[model samples]
Target chain A: MPVQLFGPVQVSDTVEIPERSGTAFTLEQGDTLIVIDPRGEQVADLLAFNAEDVAEIISSGRTFDYAETIYLTTGHELYSNRSRPMLGIIEDTVGRHDFLLTPCSYDTFHHFYPKLQPHRGCFGNLAAALEPYGIAPDMVPTAFNCFMNVPVDGATGKLRVLPPISKAGDHIAFRAHMDLIIGLTACSAPDSNGGTFKPIHYRIERG
Target chain B: MPVQLFGPVQVSDTVEIPERSGTAFTLEQGDTLIVIDPRGEQVADLLAFNAEDVAEIISSGRTFDYAETIYLTTGHELYSNRSRPMLGIIEDTVGRHDFLLTPCSYDTFHHFYPKLQPHRGCFGNLAAALEPYGIAPDMVPTAFNCFMNVPVDGATGKLRVLPPISKAGDHIAFRAHMDLIIGLTACSAPDSNGGTFKPIHYRIERG
Candidate 1:
């Protein structure tokens, strides 16, 4: 599917992360990264690091602490491990997102099937995407689970993976606070829309 | 690190899923599936289906209901969607394993880094592993997250990813109650043992 570009912003960089794959690019300060849930049923795992120091990467704990909410929506700022603002959700078509859920990995699939090996998980995808930038897998930290529906069971405090409540072409855009290296993984969890993981479309625009 | 094979169980099959990869296999009734966490840090996502009917596959929700606990240990029988016993854990070197979490996917990685395409996720791994048996991606379902440490906060009900408490060479073995097709994805999350995703060792034996 073609990548969709949002209006009014001067487009500088545009990339499309196909189903079960990843892409990497640099986002300058004030640049806007637009992530599209093309099919509206897919969830996108987002990870990022400051161009100056990777150690000060995205931290879900900090983001949640700063936002004072378990879920993220428009006007919320994503914080790095250093409690620094990295990206701000200036626009959000879908109101629900998961800041509480960690990224999925091979361990996740291996739980259901013992014979299989660790395949492409978000960790691997992020590692591969950041390899060129000298980023290590261990440096890849927590994420903002965009469009992922993880409702917390009030009684037992359990997390349920439900289908996205977003519509086709719905998206969330983040404004970069600094020069950043960003990665994207189209979630491949079966719970992600019952295994028919649709692709995600994204574009970076000059603000 | 080297791959370790357990005692004289007469291994009939052996497979290794490299970091960010997956494997698939089958076992007859009474056979055994051994999953080894060579580094004791990686998690394995497990998925299975009755050989006679793929629709009757392992279900995390059902397994949790039957096990009556979120963590998996020896003697816990994994249940299918129909709440039928599938794999019975005969032995466990590590007492703690998580069944509360779901597998990792591309959408997961893409959420943080926008440029990344979907790379390896358990769903892709399971599909690739089950392809020989004609299992499609959409058919790949939720998993039993083995060796994963997802501790939930009691007050806020948030999930936290932590390093596994398992030691090197730790393993978990399950005995098949019926003919079954299984898939596995090695846990590849950075939060999984600080990102040095060591390889996993596995073998099937005649019981």
Candidate 2:
């Protein structure tokens, strides 16, 4: 199981990704971004890209492939497209995560609530967050789902969605390897975290 | 088995996603993106996001969940995270496709070639293609793998990667349900397409 190590620190910046919205910020190399599931059930779409080039970003597939493990917690390094270390998990309060699933998007809600057109989702939230940086919504890529619950049936690989194991104030921290543009989205999926959507809080700490 | 249906049409756009690289293009609601494995062994990372909202992108988990199948081919509607139809598979010359696995990334290759250090992967390719639009590499989500073979051991759900069954010129086509920014990456994994990497050709056609 994953355990938290970094609990107290001097924070440089703290902000909340409003329910169903997204946030973007910058973190210098060696800095750490702490993603907090304030309510214990909400999921956060955690994404990062090289400050100079967006093409070299963190890849969940590679993270799992290199780790040779399905679950991630402290000590795991999130790798970029070029295999460069992007972030290292220095602390994690919740060991269970859903790197296997993509963040919920408008189309995901439409699958169940077609009549509720333009439903909010993590995909939209991230796009909105990146817009100020001149990134078009269509160019936004997939995300690394943090705090999401997706349990795989070890016997069959069948996935079962569940509520997050985090508690209020539970957080995870990553030490950046390069200057990064961090994008985050507060997941709004009704099925996430026990059929309710919640907000997320985060902070960046630099030495 | 999935079968091809649409054929012999004027190409609106024809381009090659070179081996170890990625390509990004646009397709209107009625337009179709035809991915061609020129040498019949290359795997393509197929991804798409709403032209209006990048967050409304494709999700392999939802696609398989809604389709109720692990394999994808003709007749399957590539659903977005919201469960709305994004692309409809009108044709598939090669019936076997992988939706259960995430796209290859730097970490994925490092597992086998730690010394290779900077092994190229589909994740980086896609991130590059979206660079012009300001979408960072970390934002490139999981992908729909086309043509690469991944045989599932039924009882165990153990995935065994294999060479593509498609011959040269084998292809797949998807009719967009909405305006879309489609991304494609020619997988460069050493084990892809029978131990050799190849290029992929694609074209968009409008009714």
Candidate 3:
């Protein structure tokens, strides 16, 4: 079992994103959002938008450009397309994540997993969950994939999706820089989750 | 003067995209779109969308994932969000290109070039040019930056944007797999164009 560190002082609520599903909620500034992979090797896709304006969505390019590294972990800030900070990684146990890939969609299923039943992947899940917040599908940008182990070959710049190294109970936490609308998911892509579907747990904590 | 090779057999009208501006046009299947940097070191941001459905836009993630390399060039196919091939590179004089970075925007200037006059940048330029086609700004995805030189550090995966090495008259040609709406720009970001801006020229041809 993985040990949880730097977690919330008081337990408010833990929301379970069932296997292959997603949810959306609001997190106020200074509050920490803890996303937990209850079972080992599960990947969670995360997105954030400014509460004041949905047009200001999280930008992977801005984050990668400012951070100066693709390996984003503690102390890194996620920036919006408008160049404003949205979230900061306050604490993290599993450091490996993916900001290079877009959320998988129904087309992803059709292209990669034709042998399996067609299903709306994480993109669709995020779109549906965020719909209530007036965020459209096209508005969804590249996601901050927590615990997704995608390795890019240095010499060739080739990418490979590998099983996540995050063990059971491992988690990553972020503190909001502004009032934000967040869409998160227990990823549905088989390749991303090491061929197993699992639940993701998260909670919002306030001081 | 750079030698143009494997160009269209017959002559066609060449459209000049003024410095710091953009334009949109439709290319039918099997037709080729050739984008040229009239005076080199200029970066032209390019975007493609399925003419049938605007929602099925070009996807850098899918293209990179399928091509297995971030350095996309000759013979590579650019894929859409739905995993369909949108265009294929038939010729490229300057092999270096960028698919990882989002189009530079007003916010990008605000963040990086605060002292410089605030320009809409390529993102805004593309949005404006594509608006008549019903493509909202939010629908724009990461652009395929032609002639842009962005090298990623092998050990750290850090990205650095350097001035394009393309010389005068350097160009790239892409054959459309499906009818596509193309948005091309003479990049507005100073850093991207090596502290100066120049015109981008393009012409569509049917064999």
Give the Å shift of residue A152 in candidate 2. 4.8
Per-residue alpha-carbon lDDT of model 3 for A69-128, expressed as tens digits?
777899999988766889999888988898888788888778789999988889999999
Docking class of 1: incorrect
The root-mean-square deviation over C-alpha atoms between each candidate and the true structure, in angstroms, is 14.4, 6.7, 4.3
Model 3 alpha-carbon drift over 4 Å, by segment: A1-11, B1-11
- Fnat per candidate: 0.03, 0.15, 0.40
Cα lDDT of candidate 2 equals 0.75
What C-alpha lDDT do the candidate models reach, one value each?
0.72, 0.75, 0.87
Residue range B104-194, candidate 1, lDDT tens digits: 5554445533564556566567777899887766555546767877666544545566788777788899999999998988865566555
- What is the per-residue lDDT of model 2 for residues B1-207, given as tens digits with 9 covering 90 to 100? 222366544446468777778888888888878899998888998888888877676876567556645577789898876567999999999888876556676667767657665665777777778777666665666678898776654333345678989899999999989998888988878776687877889887765
A1-207 in candidate 1: lDDT tens per residue? 333575546565446677877777888999999999887788888988889876567766456534545667888898775557999999999887776544555655565435655565665777788999888664554467788876665344445678988889999999999999998888766675555767888987777
List the DockQ of the predictions in order: 0.04, 0.19, 0.45
Decreasing TM-score order of the candidates: 3, 2, 1
Cα deviation at B16, candidate 2, in Å, is: 12
Enumerate the chain B TM-scores of all models. 0.88, 0.91, 0.95
Model 3 DockQ (Cα-based) = 0.45
Give the DockQ-based CAPRI class for model 3: acceptable
For candidate 2, state the interface root-mean-square deviation in angstroms to 1 decimal: 5.3
Model 1 chain A poorest 10 in a row by lDDT: A1-10
